[model samples]
Target: MPLQDNLSGYNSGGSDPSLFFLSGIPGLEAMHLWISIPFCSVFAVALLGNCTILYVIKTEPSLHKPMYYFLAMLAVIDLVVSATTIPKSLSIFWLNSREINFTACLVQMFFIHTFLSMETAVLLAMAFDRYVAICNPLRYTTILTNSMIAKIGLVAFARSFLLVVPLPFLLRRMPFCQSHVISHCFCEHMAVVTLACADTRFNNIYGIFVTLFIVGLDLTFITVSYVKILRTVFSLASKEQQLKAFGTCISHLCAILIFYTPVVLFAIIYRFGHQVAPHIHILLANFYLLFPPMMNPIVYGVETKEIRYRVHLLFQGKSF
Candidate 1:
């Protein structure tokens, strides 16, 4: 009897799958070529965009401020996040290489979750930068100094690593009795978690705990920072000043929505949407990971005047 996957309706050859199989898109394999076009295009754009932001920030003296520092960090993170899954996803689509070893899958699981958490923390840090720059202009530089930025980066990586490193170990100890096919593009945490036959309550609980702890807590602080920023902007004496103050936040606001909205929706649906068609869940899961990396550089580069000016200068044969 062919095995049926609850989430994706994917079928497996054997009752006990030795290697995890990755799907490009469930029920849409015939369109893999067409799908690969967009995925590849986005991947290229993400790489080029992030690299441009990093290069421009690195070479431009004026972009050495805390906000640009945070943006550079974001560019690096977006590059990693996009790299972790997109290549393999494209491989699955283009070369028909859908199999992934358990060890390899766990590695993918670790990087994707950990780096995304780092991105979240970096976003929060950026929000704080905005908050201080708007609310306490004189103190912005003194507060978010180079050393402070380095420390914030350190904490973001450390916290994400410590919290998420255990997840792969937890999954490793579990035995798989059902089809080990991950119905999504990459080895998504919950998608892999659902394959284990043994008790996964601990894994499930811990995953949720980490997600809430990192995402929930960071989003809260970012919200508070933004609210304060809004108050400061609105209190500016002139309408032009208020608009200018508020304009600086547009990129970050877009980033917050582009990143978090899909994440929260995906997390909720994965946990509780028993009735959801697997394709929708899988698409939402892919959206959260893919969309942000492709959008972040575009968002920041277009919104931040200094970066845009430098980019134009670079194109016009201007050095540095």
Candidate 2:
């Protein structure tokens, strides 16, 4: 459909929108410009930070371990997530800014979910790595071999790909009889689904079920793994082992909290709170997407002494 005639339903006086597929909100040009600065900054940082981590791990043989492998995987996924969103975001800033074609919107939704699920899987893998190191230290080498790490990375990527692909397809099949203008900046799945013209009973239920399955399942597994880890830590023979184990995990825990809490809180406020400032919600939503990339390197660099030293050496080399 032509853009002008396709978008002629902004004044129908009904609460619903006019399109049949997932379209972004209108009138976000200024807001899009405002967000582009931070989005670009974070994108550059995530790319550099993750690339540097990958480089340091690749160059330094001593740092070639299971933990760093998973960290590198995480950096790669963060880079993917940031890259997926930023260009579309920049497009929004330059173009009419709200006219996301149905096809491109679906692609964005796919990658967003894929990277998010991948991050969850990576975190679970990290937790399992911690579990082995803390709870089964004697067999850490045998347990997390290079082949095992490779397999785990493959499985994580595969599962994320499988889970995320189905959702965008399901969404694409739905008829968006209503709103074209998504209230939020990006083409988030729920925000997109809510604009569907057909009955969204299935979409809403599926979204909730998937949320419970992916995020809920990952959160459950992570909690159980950490509980076991905490138990093992307390039973350690020396304070040094205990402290070392605790220090290694503190950053992951912090990252998890920082990433998940805003999402949960946003869900609650959007569903229940009546007075949510659109700007506040928009900022928080952007934070939900951007903050983790910013925090990942900082958390790892600060928490892991090895990574810290590696970063320092990189900087020192630059100085020389």
Candidate 3:
């Protein structure tokens, strides 16, 4: 049998609840029911929360502005991310030694990359929206028309699809002659690529370059955009307008901080932090990917009055 076939249900060590997928979820901690329960709970919350955001934006005309248009895109990306990782995680908690075929792993990896790519693009779009609104108020309408926004969304999805399409092909060509045990919970690009017994210098280099190009470049632009936004907000005619703009940005800022902080930490841990504590690396990975999706909608609902009110009305019927 090929190495992939051999690894169908292979456990690196004796079946410990922590190391093996107890039910069927990969990298799930079956022994630590406490941890698994919380992870599942938050995963459900993020899925539902992002879904609700999409529903509300689709239904409500008031939220059809450029800002909310970008927000709706963000909601879709978060939903994809949550959906992609959560089931595999839950399977580990519920089913012991669950098997995922090589094809299935490739599919999961594709979605992970696609959603992450879209997220980076949406963040950039949001930054541009704010820049136009605050910095060039007169042309905001002209620049961010409905057709234009739709084109932006299309471009983002196309970019994600094109970039991630080659990943599975690369994986298929590589020879995994030895270990099939993946270190990370999910079929992360780096984690999976590292498992190949043959040299993966080209794959690793391409992966690193792509990550830096997407995440690093996006972050740099976002920072520059925010700096310009701050300058514009400060120059506003009234304190009230400035405060409102600041309030509008708070949720986006919070999302950026949560999203980026873990990414940087993960890079450090995956590279240097590995020597110190293995569990620390795992814990950081979980937090970095899982926590932001769970908290993003909650933060937006609290900071954006429209979303908060709509969500409240959704739960509390009409009479009140």
TM-score of each: 0.93, 0.87, 0.88
As for lDDT, the candidate ahead, 1 or 2, is 1
Candidate 3 Cα deviation (angstroms), residue 269? 1.3
Arranged by TM-score with the best first, the candidates are 1, 3, 2
Better of 2 and 3 by TM-score: 3
- Estimate candidate 3's alpha-carbon lDDT, on a 0 to 1 scale: 0.77
For model 2 the local lDDT of residue 189 reads 85
Candidate 1, 1-320: lDDT as tens digits:
22234223324434335567887688777888898998899899999999999999999888899999999999999999899999999998888888788899999999999999999999999999999989999998799999999999999999999999999999888877656677889998888898887888999899989988998899999989988998899899999999999999999999999899898898789779999888788778778888999999899878888888898888799896
Q: In the order shown, what is each candidate's alpha-carbon RMSD?
A: 3.1, 4.0, 4.7
What's the lDDT for residue 173 in model 3? 84
Report lDDT (CA) for all predictions.
0.88, 0.76, 0.77
Residue pairs in clash, model 2: 17-178, 17-179, 18-178, 20-176, 24-182, 25-181, 25-182, 176-197, 177-197
* lDDT: the better of candidates 2 and 3: 3
For residue 274, model 2's alpha carbon misses the true position, in angstroms, by 3.8
* Residue lDDT tens for model 2, 1-320: 45444455532312342323322233343466665776778878877887888888888888899989998888888888788777766665656445566777788888888888888888888889888888898999999999999999899888878767777888878765545666655778887887766887877787777666888888898899999999988988899988987887887898788678877887787678778666666667667787787779878888888888988989888521
Candidate 2 residue runs with Cα over 4 Å from true position: 1-32, 94-96, 318-320
